[model samples]
Target: MEYVLVLYIEQALKKGVVQTMEMGLAEMGRVLRQRVLLIVLVTLLAVGLAGAGSFLVLEPEYEATTTLLVQSKQTEKGIAYNDLLTDQKLVTTYGEIFQSRMIAEAVIERLGLDLTEQELLENVRVRSSSESLLTAVTVTDHDPKQAVTIANAMAAVFMENLGRIMQVDNVSILDTAKLTSDVLEPVRPKPYLNMAVALVLGAMAGAGLALLLAFLNNTVQTEAEAEQLLQLPALGAIPFFEQKGSSGYRVVVRQDPRSAVAEAFRTLRTNIQYDEAGKHVKVLIVTSTLAGEGKSMVLANLAVTMAQAGKRVLLIDGDLRKPTLHHVFHLGGQIGLTEVLCEGVAPEEVILPSAAGPDVIPAGAIPANPSELLGSPKLRGLLSDLRIRYDLVLIDSPPLLPVTDGQVLSTLCDGVLFVVRSGEVARDQLQQAKGLLERVGAQVIGAVLNGKQRKRSEPAYSYYAAPEGDPHD
Candidate 1:
């Protein structure tokens, strides 16, 4: 029984390790996919530079080789095994002598070359195998004819000096270095080979750079990232969309109700309704960590979506300092929330109606003390009165970290729907903003992850889309 239990534990541990590895690979693949364009551009730039250097900057070098045979003096009874062994041993000595400085200088003088002994020796090579008695002399130069001439001269000088230095006449030239019109290809500055190597190295470097950039990025990009950082439930994920020739806020739920963005808003509405089993979120504040995160646009569309579901919804622009809902709904912003809060104007008179099914109350004017006005007792009373009149009241407030207006409004509202735009707000900023709301004892119902990048494999609203010729489309 003990062994069985131990075996079971081992199997479970292996399974857990496998699962962790799979998850890590999946996350890496997602990061690579997100930065594929940057990697491609870097790779192409490297390849271009390599091609230029290979073709335009570097000089080509040509090589020519001559072969020589080293043999022992043959006896009348033919060659013996010991003679062949002696010749093999002599091959090594002959190879070194062929690359000596004396041979290099002699070859340079014989060929009338404009090069020093060391420089000519640097371009010459000698190779011989242990089992063979043949030595090859190779010389490289910028000009093909110079390379051939140097190679043949080096072999001749080595043979003439060998008889005088070692008193041996066993070396003979087997093949002379000959230049031909058909065989003038340079050995160095191989453009195709260099480009291939550069291609591989550049791709590796680009991939590494992309991974480093992904690691350094601290922004919240996906719904999972937002939920993991803020510890908040994701009520809905709205994919990003853009319409040409359209400006200001986009009420996609009202204009193109059959589109994917509209479907996302409707999904958000359904999730909000089902968030709490027996409770309903009546007065909600929609806010983000920073400005331009699309909180106002999200609130406008959410209010319209709720109203489309047979609920009386009121959309209020709660940002007193930088009001934009007036511009969004194309209404005059001279008299709305500020007048009702500071000037004690009646809320019913300033309330405007829109064709998008939601009652709009734009921010009246820029206020010097937005935090004080939002935190007033009269403002609480106004919300309480408005909450009773409408089934759902959605307030678009300013960013939380920039000012205290959103936190103040959170205390007066029934719930807060935090908006997080993909790759816009950092993780620390969202954490700090959520901490501020929590400090005020706000009821954060859930979060709405906006501007999420949709995957290519994931079809957007195609199942609910009407046919091309259909009137609904």
Candidate 2:
């Protein structure tokens, strides 16, 4: 039981991370845009740190350099100095005297420093150039005056220590170390260079994080995702329409009647006609996983498209809760479906003619029991009567997952069409909606993607949603 409980907790945490990553990838472009201000602020902060940290943390320490001269005595011919070739042999001895603790201790004592011989040695450096007997000693300290004093003291002590240790007077300081009266500048923390490094590092980090998120994410954001998830052939893609006017609403077959939008609907119409199993599509229902998915608008435009093709299309405003079909056609909602059911009006009579719309039944009043009304026997009978009167019946339903209205109506319809807004409906939510329809045995033919982005690289599928605003789907 404990092992099972631990497994359950681990699964839960994994699910949370997966969900977050999926959401990020699904909205990758929008997420990048949203973080623009944050990226700018981070760059500014890096610059400020580069500038302020450079000035305070750096301390100046001056260095004093002095060279020692040693010449080898050698001659090709007979000479007194030729017999005494001792300068070359004295090089190592001279180098050791400059580095010895005794010489360093004497220098510190003469210069009046309270530091130990080891501490004094830390400030002194002795070395020779390549193939040369010239020894160089350098002393560094916080003040220029003190650095010069230590350098001269160490040089004087090195000569004294060399005569005693090597038993020869072969070493001497060529020049005395002195103070220049000017303070040496500190060298540390280059602000410009630091800022540049930070910029490069920060950009690389951001890019790595973005790629990691993109790879791990699995939410449905593309039209390709919908096609792959449902395993259905894509029918057609409708461009997002902003409003109901000339520029808005892509059902150009209904509005413009001669443009590309009209062309797309005709293509969709052709696909529907070619479906052998779904060829007898009469009473069709359109719905989505959530509201604001443009189900009503798509329904209106599809009906309009069929009507233009010389088919008697009947558009029904089946969303009894929040009826928008009535407003779109500017029709009189004085009496509609509720009145037809209660007042016993003929199904044909409730079907009103529109000025531009083919035929529509406006939702007269807000019904209390929407699911019940849709599930009633009258709805099927009404559909049968309308099927004979009109060539096609288009039923606009509420969101599938939000209510059971679409589910109840689906049983009576010939087939159902699900509308999914790209980037708006989460992958899991759509999966849930699909599961609900399957449980109820609804025949979902294919999905209609409503709003699509303008990006060319984006795959052609149902719809595309961005962070800016609603792409109709």
Candidate number achieving the greatest TM-score relative to the actual structure: 1
What C-alpha lDDT does candidate 2 achieve relative to the native structure?
0.72
For each candidate, give its TM-score against the true structure.
0.85, 0.64
Residue ranges of candidate 2 with Cα displaced over 4 Å: 1-188, 212-219, 244-263, 458-473
* lDDT (Cα atoms) of all candidates against the true structure: 0.85, 0.72
Clashing pairs in 1: none
- Model 1 lDDT on a 0 to 1 scale: 0.85
